[model samples]
Target: MKTQIFYFSSTGNSLCVARDIGNAIGGEVELIAIPGALKAPRPVTASAIGIVFPVYMWGLPALVRRFVEQLQIPASTYVFAVATCGGNAAGTLAQLRTLLEKKGILLALGEVIRMPGNYTPMYGAESERSQKKRFAKEKIAIRRIAPLIADRKAGKVDCGTWLGRRLLSGFVYNGGMKQVPASDVKFRSTEPCNGCGLCVKVCPVGNIVLVEGHPRWQHHCEQCMACLQWCPQVAIEFGGRTQGRRRYHHPECSASDFVW
Candidate 1:
């Protein structure tokens, strides 16, 4: 199948998942960055289309929802989604299914893979040993999902029960999500920042720009934590809460991995 995987990532987990699946699916699988794809919007025509991204606030990131809304998929395409999260995927997969449904396209598959959590506002990074364990498990999970996608398998979307989904996602969906576009307001660079300009480079949305050698947010942030996690000096902080939090990104990925 001519598979095209459109993905969005902040700290690299979702991108790594997309890469593994694209490699395992055994075809011409093209990994496309969602931000870059949005730059030139067009009707997407492919035998298989995969939307891979990190789950935020128990649901899709606001930018991702917009991306899906703008997507134009052919009727016969096998559409799938893989949501990577540190916790339960909750209603994230179901949310994608609903969005696709609105477009008259049935989401053929939805899967969630748990990776190391990087939302420092809520917690610190896990132990290095624990993170390694997650990386191993992530590979195994992707291995299993690749074949199902290759076969165009469709069953129950993997979202949790309706009650759990509503209870978990609804709590913050209205309040927190509405603030996502402006959530960059919480980010600030500490004294350790040296104007390396790396944050500006890693931001997938081009939300960060150099301002007199300091990074400034444009309020269109996705909160992907790329700048926070990938900053070499441990400088970026989220609402002053992430000052001491350990930064993390997919071990297999680097600052230069955004080619797609």
Candidate 2:
């Protein structure tokens, strides 16, 4: 059976899981990237269709949610999703399941894999030892999920807390979405910036543009923090908040992996 996995990853955690799952399924696996310019639902027909992405604000990222809303899939196609989060997936899987159901898509499987935390605005990157431990856990989770996906088994990952899922998560996620449009104004490059354009390229939303030598932020930011986290010279900062904090991307993920 043909399998295709669509993914959006700022760091590399989601991409890594998608690739691993694809390898294990052993068919023609197409790993497609969800870019920033997603404006329409596209048709997808395969024996199996999967989406792997991170959990943001206890729910789906706005772009990913938009992608799901517009996606067109065959009724019989086996559908699954995997959400990667640093902590509490909260309502992510539940939200996705509800959204897919609205489109008559039966999401057969929902899984969550915890990876090293990457939300630097809240905390610095985990220590190397801690990250190593989490990566090991991620590997085992992928192994367990692959066979189920290969078998087209049906199940879901449960989101916790009635209050969190029904009320709190929706509020926070919606507020985050509202803030997304103008969030780019908070990002600025430091004096260390050398016009390498790494930030411009790392941004999935194409929100960064190079003016003369340095990078400039456009108003439509996803706040994925890829550009800030992956800057080679540690030049990008979100206001004064991220100045001295550590940056993180999946250890196994490189800039090349993000190329289309």
Candidate 3:
């Protein structure tokens, strides 16, 4: 059966998981980038459609949320969603199911993969040793769950219990979104920036634009961190707050890499 993997990633954690699943299944991987970005629609007729993304502020990333609301999926397609999170996925899976079901699509399965915490303000800098441990755990979890999705398993995918949802929602949305100081969201640039414009080219939301030979964020960012994380020269930084911070992306992925 033909399968397509769709995803939106910031720090590349979600992208890594999406790529691994696509490689394991030997399926075509498609990127469901944000609106106004370069992307090809998934051919969903009689095929398996997989969505992999990160949970932001207890919900989908603003861009991913908009993408799903506007997405037109085939009625007969088999749908599955996988979320990568530092801790909890919040209500992402349930929200995705509700949206897709309205379009007459059925959710076959859902999985959550844990990765290094990238929400800098909230999680801080996890040690390389800790990140290694988390990645190893996630690899095992992905292996266990990958086959279940490939087999087309049908069952209620439990992300967590009701209490878990409530707690996670409070932490991700209230603690991370509402309460986090704006100063924490600031970013910086390093000397490596050659002003190549790749960040502008790859930004799905047009959040970054080249200004005077350097990329400048116009305040109305989705906080997807795509520009900061995907800079080819490692030039983008989160201002003084993230200065000297360790940058991360998927091991084999790069700034100009396109999944589809």
Q: Local error of candidate 3 at 141, Å?
A: 2.0
Scored by Cα lDDT, where does model 3 land?
Answer: 0.68
Candidate 2, residues 1-260, lDDT tens digits: the string is 88889999999999999998999888788888877326334456578999999988888887788788777777788999999999888888889988988888888989989998787878889899999999899889888888899988987566667887877577777777788768788888889999998887877777888998899888988788898888889988887678789899887889877644
Per-residue C-alpha lDDT of model 1 across residues 1-260, encoded as one tens digit per residue: 68899999888899899999999988788888898888777457578899999988888888798899998887788998989999788888888988899899999888888899988888998998998998899889878788899898874578877875787776767578888878888888888889999999888788888998999999988887888888889888888577677777777888888633
Query: Which regions in candidate 3 have their CA more than 4 angstroms from the true location?
Result: 26-43, 123-125, 164-185, 188-194, 232-240, 258-260
Q: What is candidate 3's lDDT per residue for 139-226, written digit by digit as tens?
A: 8977877777677677556456676566765455556554222432476566888989877876666666777888877665767666
Worst 10 residues of 2 by lDDT: 36-45
Rank the candidate models, highest lDDT first: 1, 2, 3
Highest lDDT, which number? 1
